[model samples]
Target: MSDTTVTSSSIRNLIKANIRNYSMVLMLALIMIIFSFLTDGVNLNSRNFTNIFMQNSYILLLAVGMVLVIIVGNIDLSVGSVAAFIGAISAMLYNSGANMFVTILLSIILGVLIGAFQGAWIAYAKIPAFIVTLAAQLLFRGLTYIITNVSPISLRDDNFKQIASGMANINVLTINGVYYTALVAGVVVFLIYVVLEIQGRRNKIKYGFKVSPMSFFIIKLLVIGLLIFGLSQRFATYRGIPIVVIVLGVTIIFFSFITNNTVIGRYIYAVGGNARSAKLSGINSELVVFVVQLIMGGLTGLAGVVFTGYMNSALPQAGNNFELDAIAACFIGGASASGGIGTVIGAIVGGLVMAAINNGMSLMNIQAQWQYVVKALVLLLAVFYDIYTRRKTGLG
Candidate 1:
């Protein structure tokens, strides 16, 4: 009877733990379902579903970076302003008859320059990141107004626009007698995951750490297979996945590797979890912050390119209030404000949730005021759940 009691208690604990971990994802699905019915099933079309990623790619980019910044116990209020500045620069270069290649290179360089400048202020001069980035937000936004004269710069560069507009359908595959591009892409993705898993396990064993549980490994593979297949099917009958989706997927994998596999990543987590202790342990906290910001700036530049290309224009006000969306996405993804906790996967999930909210409400033809109200309420609920879960786990 004691053993039975133990099993029951353990099962209950597992249920609670899972509920806490996956509540946001569950909420996202719930919203999707509610909006699907509300829109008479018009909200989940293959094309419209893919459009969500194209439209919100920049938000995903910014939120990924912001998660790192927030994980390190810092804030960057300047990203929106930086994006606006770079968008103007990109527009100017394209208008000057510069090639798309040159324009992209210049914009990324300028963004890195801005990040280095901010890092110098915060890391070397010892200014608080909040103050430095806040000031930067104002200054860069002001600069954007000056650069573009508050006018919209419509892009006429075909190659540049194609970067955000094109889709990679791969080739069609006969799957159970149905010709499907999703099936093709799904197979490729699953093979890639399998190869990667083997390589990762080999590396772990090479380093002498215990390999992850075989059951866990298989579970991860299954989950990835399902996700890739699901998303591929959703967009299969359309134009396949957008190039922007490819970009977002690469960013997710890249950052996930950074956060999980590198010393810089470890130091980032340490500094965020406890700065003074990390310092005493010989971690260069400031350098970590600087490098992270540098990377953030570069990603912002990339996001700007995609954003402008998708719109076929760059406006001085293109990124208005975008920082809010990015920050909200990060926090909603289970990132702790206190630092040292966040995952690339979580950030993606968070960004998708917000995008779903926007897209679904629009599909339902909800009033603008009600949309805003509903989004605000969802944001509040996500944050509250995060707080409650953390406290319940004694991590708050």
Candidate 2:
């Protein structure tokens, strides 16, 4: 074959191999377009779209951790209950006139302790995570009720509430009545993303690995950059970028870096890929599992803080079904049910897909029952796709 033909084949194969990496994002965009049309523009309203981010902040946080848990071939059914328990503690502290900082600190420390306890059983004692976390789900839920007396505790601290509802504290500029902070941030991020993409392609080519054609790479970057810019413009017209958006963005970036660049991250993937082999290779699979659970607990604590702030209260039912949403997001975002195959970015896309569906259906006046049915169907399809891909790749 000619050199041109070989290059073309490499690009084609690269696209096929990584199709799932971008599929969920495409689905999310398609869902947004469809809902925009169906809702007569209501679903795409700047406020409504931004609300999706704010509303799903906790689920997104849970998703960041849940993907790691699922990738490790384990589950965390206790996250929602842990969130509720933490929220209750925060509320109790705030109501008792404690400083907001102290309340948050204590809540997170308690969450870490809870994680350590559960991790010990699942990791060291050889208990199944499903059973352990299920027990913890009931245990922490009961504790939430005990703490809150099966009632809601209202929040009165403005600072505490701001974690979920506040906008960025500073604005760079305003042009033609548009806040420029988000737009500027969007541009900066786009530049960084483009640089990284180009660098990745170069590295792949240098290593003789297959890579998408330059044309395809450019197109993908353009679409993604435009999406970010457009979303920022929309938010610019409303409130400045939200504080929760910053939190979520930071979480995604930080975790992405951890999983992609760090030795600990490689160990995690190794453990998930094969615990026995990983242990033999000195990867410390149990330690990875334990640390993952600990991180999940920390994220759950943060979610509790955000959840409480969003509602301005902590109640018995505050975190009901949250763990389910998080897990579904992971599965829908292209995570393998078996383990060792997922991405931080994919989890975010999956969370947004779920959030978009919920927001769009509400805008269309769809009944709650139908919303559940729709989500169930979508999740089923995603898992089926994962299984199909695994089988095709001989991983199943």
Give residue 89's error in model 1 in angstroms: 0.4
The C-alpha stretches of model 1 lying farther than 4 A from their native spots are 1-20, 169-182, 194-220
Q: Using TM-score, give the best candidate's number.
A: 2
**Whole-model lDDT per candidate:** 0.82, 0.89
Candidate 2: 10-residue stretch with minimal lDDT: 8-17
**By how many angstroms RMSD does model 1 differ from the true structure?**
3.1
List, residue by residue over 236-305, the lDDT tens digit for candidate 2. 9888789899888888878877887578888888888899999999788999999999989889998998
lDDT accuracy of residue 92 in candidate 2: 84
For model 1, residues 66-168, the per-residue Cα lDDT tens digits are 8998899988899998998998889888888999889888888888888899988988799999999999999999998998888888776566777677775
Off by over 4 Å in 2: 1-5, 195-210
C-alpha lDDT of residue 377 in model 1: 84
